[model samples]
Target: MVSSDSQYSYTSSSDTELYSPAADIEHPSYISKILSKTKPDEGKARKSIAETHAEGIENTLTRYESSTHGIGPIESVLDEEKPEQFDVKPDTELNEWDPWHYPVDSETGFRIVQFVDNDRDDPRCWTTRARWNYTILLGLVCFDVAMMSAIITGDMKSPAAHFGVSLEVMCLCVSLMVWGFGLGPLIFAPFSEEFGRNRVYQTTLLVAVCFIIPCGAATNIGMLLAFRFLDGVAFSAPMCLIGGSLSDMWRNEERGSAMAIFSVAPFLGPVMGPIVGSLLSVKCSWRWVYYFMIIFSGCLYGVMFIFLPETHHQTILQRRAKKLRAKGDSSYRAISEIKTRSVKKIAKDTLLRPIILLSELIVFLVTLYMAVIYGLLYMFFFAYPVVYGEGKHWGDIKTSLMFIPLGAGTILGTLAAPFLNKDYVKRAKKYIDRGQIPPAELRLIPMMIGCWFVPIGLFAYAWSSYPHISWAGPAFSGFSCGFGFMMLYNPANNYIVDSYQHYAASGLAAKTFVRSMWGGAVPLFTIQMYHRLGYEWASSLMAFISLACCAIPYLFYIYGARIRERSKYAYSPVQGELKDPEQGIDSSAQDMRSNHQLSERVIDNE
Candidate 1:
């Protein structure tokens, strides 16, 4: 029989021996007292059994890492007396479960871990960063306002009449600019990814200023149209890069508000352009519009060059790594080094992605619907004048002023977006908790509201333009249409972004292509549509089409997530998850390529 107070000893060889205290062992006096009351040596055997269990755990960790890395075998030095204990359950579970590695701060939800200086005087404080970010957004807004002022000049009827050009020819100038704007992104987006955001912005703005100067000096319609198209190309760089720049600075939670403010500029610019252009054209030639834009663009270029630092995390990290390498540091590899693809390959892939996404069934259908909506909205630019001028006897300035209601509606819609987004997020969380699948259709609530109002506004605008009704009816209609427009546009975009997380830029590019084409084509046909059907029937036809398009959002909202789940291109946990905040891209190159292929397959099936 084993003694109760015996300590266990093991021998590996004749020359080597190790001793350890047994788990159930106690002081000799306590063991003797316990033995007096209980069975002798039972505790000694139990303690030996505990020691054996600890030895089993130590062997497991050695095998686990060996299987994972396949690095031959793990040779860990362990003390004979206190051998390392590995929990087999934890090791087995860890091997089975794939770990998600991404740079995410749980407390702040910020992608990058910002090291803050405790000193109040430090420039890297949160307050300073916030202020700088606001300034950048403001600068972008000012740039948008300046560029849009040219649209009013392009939209003017008097200049086309003076030039003895047809309405179609005049509309072509606007169409060309829209075309240039859309096409410019295909080049600029990839270039920005290669070169930095700041470099692209400053260079493009300078090009814009140069082109605007030529537009101001144009003696013929040919010169004016040519310069305007070039200016449009130059201006497109800022539009593409600014959103990415904003993403670099703000976390996902803060991004919605920033996007709201950024979104307003494009809409407001066009609305305000006509107002400013009407007054400027009346007081001075349309030449002053170009001159004013040149001056504004120049000043903005100066300010942006001075203040806008390179905020792109990948570029910043790459530069830091380069500096460290120059100093002969061995540990300064960029996160992007792991994915060693050539720049040419990246460019080729980026260029093809947007085209591939455009071919997707859902993307194509949504884009077509969105394009028609956008075209119909711009068509009103021409239609409003005819209804107000012929029907109500208003001048160009007064006709342009009528767009104020449209701007007002956009403001109201923007204010409501955050509340709507919050509600949807909560609903999504609830669905997850209940083990029920959340559909993407929950995102279309605002879009449904838009569908109801858009047609009503179109009918109201058309019917009320007759001699019997007051002008207030048409104005109210415009306001209603504007509200509907915002509701439809925002949710559609958000849905696409959320669903195609890896291919968002390409998806947006696809949408932009279709939307821009519509914007270009619609105004050209507005005169013909009105002439053939009269104002009431023309707008009513548009309303009918809009009503048909309304079914799209409803279909997607109900079945979108199901479609996404089936889709190879859609966001997924395995391939689509973002890693490395410094690299700052959500989808990997492999995932993006896979998604593009999946999108093609879905399109082909459809």
Candidate 2:
């Protein structure tokens, strides 16, 4: 789920601010005793800033921009003793009816510099070409991140033999790496808040590339597994950051197409991983798989380092404030400097809230359903080899070709995403026309349509997997499964985000954590299960489990509203409640700041 707000988390501009007594203080002047601080005025109370904060302190910044005081340009003394010394003087001779600048809240005595309407500083105001370039680049990074997770699956046999270990031990390469995917974000997502997305991306990608070298050159299984886990940890940075990056670059209306690029990357990259790894290992050696990743990730790291700008709003404003201060004008303050979360608060939001939200039936069922889908996706990596390699005595390359249909089906599902989004919009309008927020259940419509495909695909693969049967039978069955994966995965995320509005990030983080753990574990037991049950029964077992999962979306679609109403964290808006179509939450710095931290935790757990 993408947070429409660009702010992530707050960091102090100066080290002294961290321990300063002023740091503990809330806004000095503005204090609303009974009103909702994070929410805007409701109904007829909505008005311009001048009308809302009429009792603001009598400061030079306030007097300059207040409508009652008359409009004038701000004049700053660059070489000043203090921030307060840079005074705002009126220029009645040059009053040309300029729009308000450096608007100060009457109650707070704080002047928050904001981007004006169509402000060039806003990322959403960037040229379309620039935004698309960043979008595509970030999407490719996501694909590359996902691809690395499964590329090792293609030729596990050669590595397993070389290390004098069983294939099961080699499966640790995938499992441990995936475990890193879940754990890395607990640190990096929070770090991205402090350092900003670009630095995190550049640093983590470089570390990931460096770690790949040890894996390709490892002499023992331990060394390979160790570095694979490190690389996974390093690569995990981009997986979590890209969603926030997309949100930073695109507005709600423009984000659907951009997010689609992101939506396909996780599934598509893994699908291609084995296909490419097979060709590399077959033509060269198993080590070439890691070598290929090193070269690929290194180049991507270089491109991103050079081209990606800091898109994070808090980070950008922090720099702007720093630059102004460098010239001795300390009056310009970014909201980040004024409002920040403590370590304790940050820990509670990221760590505590997600765990508590999981007890909700909506989160638990949706999470379980997603975990099953994720586990199924990982299962295919090992299951393909069993079905084709062992059952029919096929080569690595032949078994890998079978993944193409799966990739194709995932692409088809991605292509169909726009249509589904359109349908959601069309359906949501009926609720909008009646002055109500659309029920979160509307998100499950796609899931209901897509839930059947998994069982169908699995069933087809199961019954068709005989040594005598044509390869097309089990091979093409992947198409349906792949399609189902996207349809279910994407909508499930939306449902969680919609169901838990202010807490969307924690809900998503909880789901990702569970799914990643399940996905990482699946590859370990997949081969054993296949061998023990025989191909038909093993595939049939998964099929039956998936068939049971088909009930999840339907169950939620029917009763989700009631469930959400009872949920402690879920946002069940009452009918006729005014909700913004674009900015779902109230536009307040406190809310945006909280949202920033919330969004930072929405990692691509896949």
Candidate of highest TM-score: 2
TM-score of every candidate:
0.72, 0.82
Worst 10 residues of 2 by lDDT: 66-75
Top-scoring candidate (lDDT): 2
- On the 0 to 100 scale, the lDDT of residue 312 in model 1 is 52
- lDDT for each residue of candidate 1 in 511-606, tens digit (9 for 90 to 100): 876677777777678878887899889989998998889898888877776677777665533323444436534334333333322221111000
- Give the alpha carbon lDDT tens digit for every residue of 381-487 in model 2: 99999989998899999899999999999999989988988898798778665556667788899999999999999999999998899999999999999999989
Q: State the displacement of the C-alpha of residue 490, model 1, in Å, after optimal TM-score superposition.
A: 2.1
Root-mean-square deviation of every model: 15.6, 11.9
